[model samples]
Target chain A: MRFTSAQRLDDGVLEREFTLGEIPGTLWTPESAAPVPLILMAHNNGLPKADPRLVARARYIAARGYAVATIDAAGCGDRPPSAAAEQARADLRRAMRAGEPLDEIFESLVGPLVEGAVPEWRTTLDALLELPGIGGPVGYSGGWTALGIRLAVVEPRIAAAGFFAGGYVPRAQREEARQVTVPLLFLLQWDDEGNPRQRALDLFDAFGSKEKTLHANLGGHTGTPSFELEDGCRFLDRHLK
Target chain B: MRFTSAQRLDDGVLEREFTLGEIPGTLWTPESAAPVPLILMAHNNGLPKADPRLVARARYIAARGYAVATIDAAGCGDRPPSAAAEQARADLRRAMRAGEPLDEIFESLVGPLVEGAVPEWRTTLDALLELPGIGGPVGYSGGWTALGIRLAVVEPRIAAAGFFAGGYVPRAQREEARQVTVPLLFLLQWDDEGNPRQRALDLFDAFGSKEKTLHANLGGHTGTPSFELEDGCRFLDRHLK
Candidate 1:
């Protein structure tokens, strides 16, 4: 991994843009002398690493004394788009406009995205932990929650996860959720128009972790309450610190 | 209201046993010069104010600078038993043992209990708020959640509530939940043996509070994680302080 640009925000959080192979990424570190626990923050629903909400959350978490990082997922911003993913997106749009069932459409769109993204994340984790100011026993945050579930199951370095639960989770990932034993803090918008509430509740119930918590608040898809940000940090603090 | 006894605990909390007319009660207050916001802590179901878990929670919240109070429901603790309530309890036990439906039995048992308790609680609040070091804008905590719903609806002094959602809520109370507009922090134990999971989720959905939050953890009825105690204080702290 090579950092291409660096700047310090007003709050003393150091933000740096970087690249690993062809994947673009960003990292935020608190102004601390000692190395801090790393949080691998994936953007919601394959959103870019630079999405405003994701950046805000990254900086907020960094100011709270954790090193946060995010990378552009496969077919996301600043990355070459896949033809098949484009076709799947078009198909999804057509299906929605036609008022068709979404199970297969969602699976096709999200399945490859999760599969492609998890490995890049693991690679980034490998590089981030090797850096001087980033350390072990990481926590995973943000969504696409399918990727979070897969990473939590496969990545032994991730000690806990905080998942945003409004994305379309594939059937395979829902099944994999049963294998994830890491402590989880899952946030769901109670009235998310884009996501069915029962599906989110069922996925939460499927999680195999003995220490999973679901914090559901009243809101639409993008309307998670701000206090949950502090709660997320506290959740990681219990596990990582 | 008449104070029967008072003592200072090891942590500097003042525990006072009191009685209002025929009802027995307890109040815990933090060591502070100024008035603190009150939390009317109802014991789970109709358990007495002196129940061990109730005392522990009351002292914990009191030490955090809130005055917490609880009272015995109509037929609980040291109060005289009502023959009707005893018959309902017997019917409930017989229904559970015989694998029979319990809707009517539960309504008979809890409906009168809630009706009787809510008024007593409101009277206690009236008396407690009149005393020095106990101020207005109260928050309600604990269960016999049916009683909580009724109180949150009828008692305008209540600003927020944290309901422990493991008790058998009467069907009438589930309907009353929609009228409760106070901000709520509802806690559900995911694996609570005695409470149906779907019922708890449905009740949470039915709440009309725009600022409501549901915190579900992996445990049975009495196994809410210790960290939730701190979280509960923070919830009340946000609204009350």
Candidate 2:
């Protein structure tokens, strides 16, 4: 992990960002050495790496002794891609869906853009998981890329998944979601225009395991409140710790 | 306003939607009869009438003894029109921009679609202003319709305006914004694709009056948190009450 910037919150709280893999992210962790669980957060489509809600959530989770990282997916946040590169990335994503090995796909798809930082995520997670008291399970949150990370990487380390406004394309991606054995929690908006309610319901119904659950909130596609984050963390604790 | 559904949050907390004009909207008003300031909220392009943040905001304002209404602008919500009718409405808006009276434009350009319980908003506001204690002050909050409403009406009864994610044609609309003498608040997102930040900044800088203030948040074109609404309510309360 590489340091980007640091700041002290109004109430003497500390916030900082670390560059991990292709994604540069903000990390909020308590000062103590006690190893706590870690959460990797990916923001909604239009939100940036330092979105206030995501920052607040990191702070909240940090206060609870969990390390929280809000990462900007490729082509988002301070690191934006050129127009041609962005189209190429989208095309590469389409190619990967046509059945490519995870490592080869990562190399061909994300490697050129990320370069050296591509392997940093695995190293960082390995280090965190190896910490003395950090025995709790790992979880992922936010939209598309978060789902991509959860589905593509069959990480035995991930104990559960909390999806916020993440939609599975029925004919295309539903089968991938069926393979996830971990307890999956879906957070959806009742009237989200981007991903309609039925899409979420369909995913819930198709989940091969009965361990999955769905919670409907009143916000739109990008409306996940702090309370929901707390609930998600608690759910992760239940399954992983 | 006609009540549609109600959800009671903790004790004395109520969230409900009502059929107002041609749109279904959520109304958050104090339980008591005491007169308070009013805010008419206009949603973003991707949101429905019952977005959770909107409902939360209405409930929050109502809890604070203020009246707030979240309305679905024309051609949205339950009032979605046929393609031809939608084109007619757009033409009517264009005609109104050309200095035509609203009633005449409505008759010639958009009369076919007008029927049933759809209230003419301007007429409704005119009637509302005549009622005792209802003349307090009015304000509009929305993106696409913010400038449209400002341009369509000659002089609204509103004392202030808080626009979120607007400023789409800043150069062309400079003259229209100049006509608004009310203290204006513009909330813009840093990386909004829909409404470019540069355009919003240009529009803010071009405003003729010092009464205008600009706020930047870290969300998409949709919206940020309740700060805009809260500040808007405070602005309206100072002028209206």
**Per-residue lDDT for B1-241 in model 1, tens only?**
9999999999999999999998899999999998999999887655777788889989999999999999988878889887888788888889988978878889889888888888899899999999898876799999668889999999999999999974479888898899999999999899887678899989998999999999999989888999899899999999999
Error of model 1, residue B80, in angstroms? 2.0
- What does the lDDT come to for candidate 1? 0.89
Runs of candidate 1 exceeding 4 Å displacement:
none
Which 10-residue span in candidate 2 chain B carries the lowest summed lDDT?
Answer: B109-118
lDDT of 2 at B80: 71
Q: Local error of candidate 2 at A217, Å? A: 2.2
TM-score of 1: 0.97
DockQ of each: 0.94, 0.02
| Chain B TM-score, all predictions listed | 0.96, 0.68
Give the candidate number with the greatest TM-score: 1
